[model samples]
Target chain A: MRSVTAENITETFIGYFGKDTDPRVKEIMASLAHHLHGFIKDTKLTHDEWRESLELLKWTGEITTPERNEFVLLSDVLGVSSLVDMINSNPAATSSSVLGPFHVTDAPPMALGADFKRHYEGEVILVEGYIKDTDGNVIPGASVDIWQTAPNGLYSSQDDEQDINSFHGVFTADENGYYSFTTIRPVSYTVPSDGPVGKILDATGRHPWRPSHLHYIVSAEGYRSLVTEVFPNDDPYLDQDTVFGVREDLVISYKPQAAGTFPKEGFELSGKVDSAFSKIDFDAILIKK
Target chain B: MRSVTAENITETFIGYFGKDTDPRVKEIMASLAHHLHGFIKDTKLTHDEWRESLELLKWTGEITTPERNEFVLLSDVLGVSSLVDMINSNPAATSSSVLGPFHVTDAPPMALGADFKRHYEGEVILVEGYIKDTDGNVIPGASVDIWQTAPNGLYSSQDDEQDINSFHGVFTADENGYYSFTTIRPVSYTVPSDGPVGKILDATGRHPWRPSHLHYIVSAEGYRSLVTEVFPNDDPYLDQDTVFGVREDLVISYKPQAAGTFPKEGFELSGKVDSAFSKIDFDAILIKK
Candidate 1:
């Protein structure tokens, strides 16, 4: 386009989109161009900044792989992921949180109320949750996928030293709309910062620490699926999650319980030589599809 | 940052900057965060869109190399490069244009009036120019670097079949502040469209063609360097350059000349050319440093 000035470049850029383009694509591209141009104009972004920013993106892409998505981490640190969660969130349902780059699709299935088949040593906590509709009625047979970091604060995918499926398990809600799992408490961990995203965080003196939490992806027939996490209310990082994924309702207490607290019947944990442990009772709420 | 809703996440993200952060970096980062959040909220961007955008970036990075910079193409097509040039431009000086990714660091120096050593054949054009200050006084001993696409409309850097220094030359204005070059006239060409940027243009139904022009970087001892291009006014793509790099003031005409009209004195083409040629007369003006 001729004579494209800073003031007119936004619309001009969007105008390049042909009339045959998808309306939704046009809208998204237009808004992105508008806001991007606005940012540049507002900052009068210097040549050095522009060049360096592009370089940062280039390096971020270079560091990305199938198992490690630095782009998602970039979005998470910038709070775009959480902002998207918040904007697209359904208030009538359990709040969705940022899904960090650690979740994989190959977690082995587990029986309800059973511990994942792991022999790691740590404070074992039983996370018990029920699936319910907006009307407070139970959704029996709801599907639940759960994952968490090891006690050392590393997800299995991030630490090759750990099993690929460590702390990962899946189950279906019982006829009573309940699901449970026994696993080591997830510890607060830093987002992998050995790459470009880490440089950005370091440049601004920001920390990459995320609060300890258990990841969950819950769904059922006739209801919307919910991807979320439960944070221990006591986590020091709760107030400053690097990804801004924390929701007050999603924070719960790991209450100390007696040795017999973990269910024995219909549960593999079943008092099998267990000591004192904590239990987190949470209910996942969903809205109708 | 607690309570990070879409409305407040912008400020929260910015507030993460530590007190010790560089003020300039803080301003740039804060403005970027604000605009990015605004775009997300404005678009109410969907999950699929967010995910797809990240994937697009990952692919763009995967394709980048030392010779090929897809990010520059990304920025150029979106008009950020041109807008930056426009805003950073000194109105009294020769207008600046996108440097583009084709420029190499090592162009061999040519004499005051000479042709590059390329053996390619096409419409030979005599390009002559004087370097001057904003007040219109010629600046003796000014440096000028020139380059352009081959007759086939592909730059040496883009087409491996061509010499690495094809059509590239460096020059120093003589005591008279005049310099000239005899090279094949550049033709309209499409930017490399075999990457993610091409995919974007394809999705938007936007063409990738750029107008024919000669690239120049001119500088004097006491004047600001000027990075610009002189476009042929008659070029069909002059009004539709994909990069929005055309400046009305930078457009020039190529006038026909007799077979022997090409300069012979202090020029390499001196009577060596047996065919009629066109000539372009343009001047580059620079502001005080």
Candidate 2:
């Protein structure tokens, strides 16, 4: 038999991708094909090299698990994951942050100013926040689900049987879009480094620490819901956050108030306790519904 | 625990990758870390969106096989595979081309000018080339291995029970760096698209067709070996090669000559049996020892 040119062969191979059946799928596949073809041409690849790549990928699949997603980590490490996020996220609303590896469904709901800190406390603090539209109107009855790492930089899920929801909480905003909770200060923490992501970090000379911040998913009727995080002003890693999640608009000052007197008028504590507490305030701006 | 400012957190993560051991692993890992962090930061990715990505990748892994390398195909579609190949291939010799899914090791070695048209025969062709230095000196005893698809664009290996190594052969160049073999013209063919690679192609509109070309792996003492293809000059899809392997230098015109006529004086072939034989002349330049 005779040998065929790579061009006709590739055309015949790619013919299997259906046309216009799904617009989104078509767009993505076309772009992917274009880039892939470009890459092949640019590099002048070989058959053995191609086969070796196939083997590596096959191994990647063999090693993946429900709890350990190597492929997602591959995409994440490749920047494709973030590129998708950038294209889909709303820039006007608070900047979105990485939905980390630990978002489990179903957390117990709590009332306003309630201490969801079931265990482990480093300081006594009163927290409050208002959910509002960009027009500055109150969004009453809004649900503000919050969570963060503990003072020791660990989450209950990160440690087996560590009952301290430590910094995890869910709060409802009042009629004025106001809510508050008490907890100890959270320190910046490292993400799991034992997997592929860790292997990658070690190879690239990068840090694994995510900056100290609070995760929030806020929702209310007649306003767009938001998923975001807020960074404190005093944390030294503010400017160089590892996950690149820090935003100037999202950073709030954590002020140190006296141990005994009412922390401050607009702040939420009524004749504060004997321990010093840090105060930070942030207003949530929703997009028009 | 209370959350700290983003700045301190950022620095900590950055330092982690920089201090890791194993330079090679460290380099790749840190690059992944830095870029991934950059992507998350640039996109401000949301947790739910990240979860969705993880699930998509998980599915990518679950459906791969030895016969069907979805991951390699994924890399191929993404251009990473080709890019890596280009970075590693010998740059000064014949241009390296993608090794499609059909090569099996241990092709039967045949004498010079031996015919490979046993199972399917429609035409008689003579493939002749020289193994030489860039300075035009012949390299004696160079090995040239050739393989291609059947007249119908099917490889013998993929045809099962057709006998292994049916259309593949290895030939030794004579003292003058001249090597000749007999084989038919290769027909353009389509690649397999029934797997994940196919699904991806379906999601994206693409055609896979390879133009007619001859695959060759040439090697000799004191020279870098080369794996490349000589494409047909008249292939209709040269410009649209799927694997991006079209190079002007690799395209050759085949001349049909009378079987028994001695067209050239210095060359011997005064009374060879032939109906119509196509002849090609090209030199393989070896890099310095």
Candidate 3:
């Protein structure tokens, strides 16, 4: 018999467990062992290499805070995050996207057609959309929560000292399933490159820019909620979204229409610009309950 | 066009990354976004749930030390370790067994018939084996590195922390591809279950115990090397190695032979018992170089 050594410690450890146990746990554990052993055997992995991987993971945990989730980023970069999502997300709803590292709670509720441009300057685009079921029935009283980036490419929350919700709002659709919000066109920008995910990108020689877009989560009784993004038709990064989240139907045309021809006159910005820079009619298709 | 707000901070962050980027980065990032978004969207996974997972990983790192590897243990119990092993262990050599997690470099080399039980006591069984090509030709100078648990069912390295190399040795084959080592019979025992792996085991309600066995790594200049474990014939745990590392061919039998049966002066057990307890012939098969 061979004396145990550090190299076989993993096996030595597993050699202790009894066979009578939950099959799921056993199967998963076995699968994990196969992959991990494969990695070591394939690489004939050295001790130092193992140590480095462990150390890197340590750094991954050390840098994560309540606000900054480096593990999520790590999982994201590893593709496990998405794999887990595929296993759980609603198959009928619009395909779910990555839950990024920055969502905080407690958004104030507001009404339709309300101005969400709390304190940012950009083209005041009227975002008019309908929340309808797949069968084309309007989902009246649907709630649509929306958010976007500043023209300077930063979120209000990114600045701890700022009171401005530069690009955030919560809006409820009217009885006719009509929803609209007044806000500025968002700008395309790069993700923060100071985290481990960023370091990995740097090491791998990759960029981190995302195209201009607006975020929306529309929900109502008796209808499937839709969490989606609408992108500008002409944004250069539209074709190169770092996260591969672009869908053709999800891209809205930014038409420069006449400002005075707009509906629902609040009596402001009579001639905001020589011509309306863009007016996009963005609607969502929610599944019937 | 909604303004960014505190409530949707996470979504805004995800949106910022999911919009656009290089094609290479896009595919990976999009998949990540989709999955992460899927986790939150599907589990309705609370922020605290996400934080808890991160904390679990953080503790996994904190508990790891220079002498112990928790992540590998995690990977092992998860089965990634064996998956990796299965993928990489070549089909050509005598099937490679789990390396386990305790191999250390710098083993002291010895000649044929040398003893490995310098600081332990048990039935002095003589283990002799042949190293040959698949064609049965003797391969001289092949090294047989061996180790086993002490009589108390613990590995010397695990129990005798102060005694370096207590039950580990390397023996070289003579001109006839024959090698021998004197040692006590390894006893079945439980593996360490005092860490996170243990907690997982307890949560799942599983016992831990490995059958009596001997570990061997055989290597010759012109033959493929092999790493394997030989289970004691009929050991209860043979069918339930917690690590799932048992292979039928690797099991050996112990026959009660007559005293002085060798009838050869070259191989003799000193301080032999009047009544022989157990004796066995163990051999290994190797592939061509």
lDDT of 1 by residue, B1-289 (tens): 2666777788888888988999988998898898889889999998888999988888898999988889989999988888788888888888999999988777888887777635778787888888999899999999999989887888888788888888788899998789987887889999889999999899888999999999999988878788999998789988778999988789898888777665577677754555657889999998998
Deviating ranges (above 4 Å) for candidate 1: A258-263, A270-276, B272-276
Instruction: Give per-residue CA lDDT, model 2, range A116-192, as digits (tens).
Output: 55556566656677888776788888888788776778776776656544456677888899988766667888766
lDDT for each of the candidates? 0.85, 0.62, 0.62
lDDT of candidate 1 at residue A14, scale 0 to 100:
80
Q: How would you order the candidates by TM-score, starting with the best?
A: 1, 2, 3
Candidate 3 to native Cα RMSD, angstroms: 8.6
Task: Please tell me which model should have the higher lDDT, number 1 or number 3.
Answer: 1
| Candidate 2, position B235, lDDT | 85
Each model's TM-score? 0.96, 0.72, 0.66
Better of 1 and 2 by TM-score: 1
The positional error of residue A249 in candidate 2, measured at the CA in angstroms, is 2.3
Residues B1-289, model 3: lDDT tens digits = 3222223323533455433455544444444344344444444443344456556676666666665666776655554444444443444444455556555446788656666676566766667778777777878888888877767776655675535466677888888888886667788877567876666767556556667777788888767677777777768777656555565556778766666554335643455543454665767778775
DockQ, all candidates in order: 0.71, 0.18, 0.10
Candidate 2 overall Cα lDDT vs. reference? Answer: 0.62
Judge candidate 2 at residue B268 and give its lDDT: 30
- Candidates by DockQ, descending order: 1, 2, 3
Q: After superposition, how far is residue B275 of candidate 2 from its true place, in Å?
A: 5.6
